[model samples]
Target: MSCMKTAENVCSTGIRIKDKKLTWKRSWQKYKYLYFLILPGLVYLIIFRYIPMYGLAIAFQDFTVFGGVFGSPFAGLKNFKTLMSNTLFWQAFVNTIRISGLKLIFAFPAPIVFALLLNEIFHPKYRRVVQTISYLPHFVSWVVLAGLLDVFINSSNGVLIMLLKSLKFNPPNIMTSNTWFVPMLIVTDIYKNVGYSSIVYLAAISSIDLGLYESAVIDGASRFRQVWHITIPSMLPIICILLIFNLGNILDGGFSQIFVLYNSLVYRTADIIDTYVYRVGIVSSDYSIGAAAQFFKSLIGMFLIIGANYTVRLFDQKGLW
Candidate 1:
């Protein structure tokens, strides 16, 4: 009887395994084209992203170009200790948090507001024109934009400065001022990204059922009331998800933008982890310390992502998980 019972269990397990294999085979057949389409992206990630992750081992070593990763002497936590004690590293860390926080507060909402306003424009052609114009700045390289802004703000004959002078207001070079530099970064970041960011919100807006609006209309709801009550609620999940994503990247601090736009005069406020790493690691050839700093940042970012996702879930909302 025991042997018969064991035989029955094995047969059931085999059947389940067979079912799973058949289900997977059907799914593969259905999505084979989609998989093929994503193959190049997978290859790119494998080559450029995953492969390069092997260099992370340098964080644990006294890395030297002559010795290479495997040949370098294992220094354990010495590099991390050095990084933690560095005043410049701490300053960069603080600047990264402050800049990223300011951006989160101001720049994050700009796109949502812009999307709401853009949705109010009923004329399709005019809406398209505005969207095209807004998206233009996002496509412009930060290098080019930074150069243009430098000319517009730093040149003695800059139009902005010239206008201020003409009005009898002697405006100093705002870019160099620590107080003004961060604000400039925030404004420029919003200007560059708001349009592109709004595309996602607009998509969310489109996905909202029209019936909700119609019902609100039937209930004598004003457009603002309808939007506040219906559209905003519909977008909450997406907003939460994006907020979590942004929190995960809180340490990034817009490296490309800041690196190009900042000068020595504004380094006090503008220097961030990425720039610090570039200076210390690439320029100063302290590769081990830089790697340790980066590894630390990545570790913190991973925790932030997990925490953010957990918080989002706690609110009974969908999360990245």
Candidate 2:
């Protein structure tokens, strides 16, 4: 009897599995076109993102170019240990945190505020003009923007310096000054990205139901109150999602912009993990240490994303998961 019962259960499970496969097959057939559309992206991710992950193993090895990944001797945690003990690495790590934190504080909110202000503009043509003007900076490459900044801030004949000199006020070379480097980075980053970043918030705002605003108006709610209660609440999910993404990238201190703008004079305030890795890994050929640093950053980012998602869940909100 027991043997017969086990055989029946096994047969039932097999039937269920077969049914699931058939269901999935039908669903795939129904959405085959949609799947085909995403195939290129999937292939790109597999090639660029997933495939490169294999090289991360070198972080645990000595990772000499001549020896290659497989030929390199396993160094265990030695690379990580060296990374931790290195003063320059620690300085770069601190600078990364400070710069990223400042950007989060200032640059992150600028977009949301700009989006809100843009939404308040009643004239469509004027609003579009403002948006176009704002967005143009985002399309400009960092290299070009940095060059423009240098031209405007150059001590000898810069537009800004000339203006200051006309007023008989001497201005420091902001690009090279350690004191001004970080502030310049923060301000310029905000300027470059605020318009582009606001696009997501604008999308979120647009998705909000018009009926909510109508209902708020019926209740005699002021514009500010309506926006406070209706617009903000509706956008919270998107905001949370973006916030989580930003938290995960807390260590990425605008590598391209900083690389284009920074010099040896301001290295104290300007050096960050990405630049450090580029110098040490590609420039000085210290691949193991660089890989270890990158691995550590990736681990931290993963944890931060997980933690942010968990926090969102605790608040009874939807998360990326």
Candidate 3:
């Protein structure tokens, strides 16, 4: 009887395994086209993102150009020690945190506010026009925008400077001013990204069930009340997710824009980890130090993401896990 019972358990387990295989086979047959569609993106990530991670090995090596990654002698913690001991690196670290924090405080909410206001617009055509105009700056490269800013705000004879002079007010060259450069970065970053970022919130808003608004209306709720009670709640999940993503990227201080817009005069205020790494690791031909800096930056970002995800989950929201 014991032998018969064991035989029955084995047969049941085999059937369950067969059933799972069949289900998976059917699922694959149904979604083969979707798999094919994602194949290119998967390939791109593997090639460009994952494959380059192998080069991080140089972070612990001397990493001479002639010796290359493999041939370079391992220096272990020497590169990290050099990085920690550098005062310029510490300055850049502080600047990166301050710049990113300022952006987070001001720029993070600009899109949410913009999207809320735009959603309140009853005129569809006007809304579309505004979106198009705002999105135009996002499509423009930072290089182009930086040049435009130079002409409009930084140049001695620039339009803004000329306008200020007409008002009998002396406007300092903000591009070179350590005090104003960070503020300039925040404002320009918002102008460049707010419209594009609003698109995500707008999408989240659209996905909200119309029935919720109807119920709110029946409850004698005004537009503001409906938005506050229903629309905002519906958007919470997406907002949390985006907040997590932004927090993860808190260390990245808009390198391309800063690199193009900043000069040696403003380096005290504008220099970030990325720019410092470029100057030290690339310009100075110290690949190991550069790699080490990048590795630490990426490590911090990863921890930020994990912590953010955990916090979001604590609020009962879905996380990347």
Clashing pairs in model 1? none
- Kindly report which residue stretches of model 3 are placed more than 4 angstroms away from their true locations once superposed: 1-47
Superposition TM-score, candidate 2 onto the true structure = 0.87
Instruction: Write down the worst ten-residue block by lDDT for model 1.
Output: 1-10
User: lDDT per model, in order?
Assistant: 0.89, 0.89, 0.89
RMSD of 3: 7.2
lDDT of 1: 0.89
Candidate 3: Cα lDDT at 246: 87
> TM-scores for all candidates?
0.87, 0.87, 0.87
Worst 10 residues of 3 by lDDT: 1-10
lDDT of 2: 0.89
Q: Write the per-residue lDDT of candidate 3 for residues 205-260, one digit (tens) a residue.
A: 88889999998899999999998998888888888888998899988998998999
Residue 141's lDDT in candidate 2: 99
